[model samples]
Target: MMKHGLDPGDRRRPERLTRPELTARREAMERFLHVATPQLDQLYNLVCLSGCNVLLTDAEGVVLDQRMSEADAAQFRDWGLWQGADWSEAVQGTNGIGTCLVEGRQVTIHRDEHFHTRNIGMSCMDAPIWGPDGKLLAALDVSSARADQTERYNRLISAQVAQTARAIEAVFFRASFPEARIVVASDEGGDAAMLLAVDKDDLAIGATRAARRALGLEREGAIRPRPAADLLGRDDDMSGFDKAERAAVTRALARAGGNVSAAARALGIGRATMYRRMARLGLGEKQP
Candidate 1:
């Protein structure tokens, strides 16, 4: 293990774990990789190319997958950034991948945020990736020395890695749990707040709790608990099911029905603008 100096106030941290706890986390990751699959390897490769070293950890901060660029890998290894490592702040001190995961958000913990002596030279950015029902899935992290990087680019790179990680998660989820409902929660708003679910065949089912709330529903309205093409203008192909997919949905609904209120509600659209769309689409009587 690498050792370094503990600045004033760093010596008294109670949250730090002993060496054995760290060793346990390290061993767990080794066990996880022993049975790794192709999809997991793909996820690791994609993350590795995204301009940051990526570390996939469990709910606990045990590193499951790690991929760094060859040059960075060498440097990281010199810093003792090996594959089987305990990423938790409690074990290795306050670094981004562990601490951001511990706090459950996208976090940047630069050098001084470290609570232990060994972590003081590293700068890291970590984003928490959540699974269905909002369970923490894994984390995407980038780490380097403070002397070699800048704040703005670091944040931008972290965000990019986070989104890439999320996409990998989406693909994995859709494939593994094909029948289970999948809801995407976006940090983007406006039309970007759109929510749509899919059935086992990947057809549009309906929205979830957050989707209904984002669309301004008082409670879970008529957007059935099952897969239904209740959304008025929704196409048979369901291309309009995402925010980027909405324009097509709106156009299709235009051809299907003219009633704005009727169509909007079905499409997870808010009521106030349903009338406006009805006027725009020149709709007649509402669909039954």
Candidate 2:
């Protein structure tokens, strides 16, 4: 508020973007908007089941799309929560979308957490959606009027929102690198799945956020387009053949639920061939 020259007690709405400015921003985000529109629609639909409103914004926190029920539309609009509104930290203070973008992670801002007094009745959850290059592309936010609820319940909802954001990031990553082979990796208990993108030459071109974290790529400062073996902790050099074989076998097993015969049939290869390849690739004991 001090940076923006606003008083602490101010309840005035922030300045909105002009028509031309909004148009330019939309045009700049055309590609991302195209890729995110369908996913955002699905996300909005899913969240609406719980009477929540969904908002999609670019990295700068300019609203691109929003979904709200008729029951809450008027109230939200009155709060200036609509398409093209600016919700950056500079503008809206400490709201969910702005704080998530600032922190580069998921956040839950409930009631009094909001800097603006007028927003004290709102509860919001937001998570950043990252591109294949590990850059912030956009954010996904779900918000509703504050309600009396246990902290545990609110945390559960926050987790759900973060999961959905990760799903969007994964989808966006796959779309950005459609030609790359996607290798699914999971945590110890196999509760979460992360995607690693390997090029035809067995190089790791990209990874989803979860994959990056699981593999410790960020800590290692591993240059992107690096060797897949480096991230996977494998010493053997991965030939093109090895990468292709592993990808095929992993996908087949995933589809077949670890049934070697079914996986072979799906790949149009003999069961013996599948078993031999799986063993060679060190994937024989790996469960999908």
Among the numbered candidates, top lDDT falls to 2
lDDT of 2 by residue, 1-288 (tens): 677664545776655678888889889877777777776777777667556778888899988778889988887877777888888988888899999999998899888888888887778889888766666778888887536644566577777777777777776778777898887755353523377888887788777766777777662333368777667766557776777678778988999898889999999999778777887898874334
lDDT of 1 at 143: 73
The Cα error of candidate 1 at residue 58, in Å, is: 1.5
Alpha carbon lDDT of each predicted model: 0.55, 0.77
lDDT of 2: 0.77
Candidate 1 per-residue C-alpha lDDT over 95-164 given as tens digits, one digit per residue, 9 for 90 to 100 = 7777787787778877767666656666777777554333565676667643656677677766656665
Minimum summed lDDT over a 10-residue window in model 1 is located at 8-17
How much RMSD separates candidate 2 from the native structure? Answer: 6.7
Model 1 clash pairs are 231-266, 231-267, 233-253, 240-245, 258-283
State every prediction's TM-score relative to the real structure.
Answer: 0.53, 0.74
